[model samples]
Target: MNHPPLAGHPADTGLELCEGSALQERGLAVSFDIQLWDHPARAFALRFDGRPVAYVNRCAHVPAEMDWQPDHFLDDSGEWIMCAIHGAIYDPRDGRCAGGPCPGGKLIEVKVDERDGKVYWYPSADVQPAFPD
Candidate 1:
């Protein structure tokens, strides 16, 4: 299904991310990309309470990717998102920093929608689709 542009911004993602098989367990993660601050930036989506939540991959602590490995953002307990660099823990549901160096900080959320068995991401003023380099 095609979605019309929003605020002159086209749909940033397609249905490829709708494959929810990998999200059966909480904390499972998937990675995607978007344009942030006019630069290519990595973002990730994770399963939490059977729902998909996404955020810019940057850690609130020091502006670094949080995953220890590609698409690996969850800790062993599968309860929270973990930053490999500074050990920052973020609430997967809302991206709020729950503990560690990041206090009163939160991950940048990327708007996503799941409908008719498809998943799509929407771009906002601050975050847009990343062009191929």
Candidate 2:
């Protein structure tokens, strides 16, 4: 019943709902500065991979958002995550930019963790590099 608070969640503030469950998590969004992508950039964070790994959520070429919806990020193939804004395909396994204008570009990996049954996104860094330090 005791855990740290998700005070720095990028999406919103204080216990944001992710994949909803009865569990209570403790963490925050890394991109807490901006609610939405300004120019369809890549950003990865709020991961369930033990710690958190987030990116800009953008494609290097067009520099667009991978998801069509606000937070609805995923690829048409589903096997790989795609950028909805510019059709950039990437490997969800590592957030690596696979196909699209920026062939060499990669998907920014989001960092996160699940203490109980809730998911939390890491806060954006002071600078830019995709994942946190």
Please provide, for model 1 over 74-126, each residue's C-alpha lDDT reduced to its tens digit, 9 standing for 90 to 100.
Answer: 88988889999989999988999999999999999987766665556677767
Model 1, stretches more than 4 Å misplaced?
Answer: 1-16
lDDT for each candidate structure: 0.77, 0.47
The C-alpha local distance difference test score for the whole of candidate 2 amounts to: 0.47
TM-score against truth, every candidate: 0.84, 0.52
Question: Best candidate per TM-score, number?
Answer: 1
Worst 10 residues of 2 by lDDT: 20-29
**What is model 1's C-alpha RMSD?**
4.5
Model 2 TM-score? 0.52
Please, what are the lDDT tens digits per residue for candidate 2 over residues 1-63? 222333555434323335424221212323332223222234444433344445565666675
Off by over 4 Å in 2: 1-54, 124-133
Q: Please list the Cα RMSD from the true structure of every candidate, rounded to 1 decimal place.
A: 4.5, 9.6
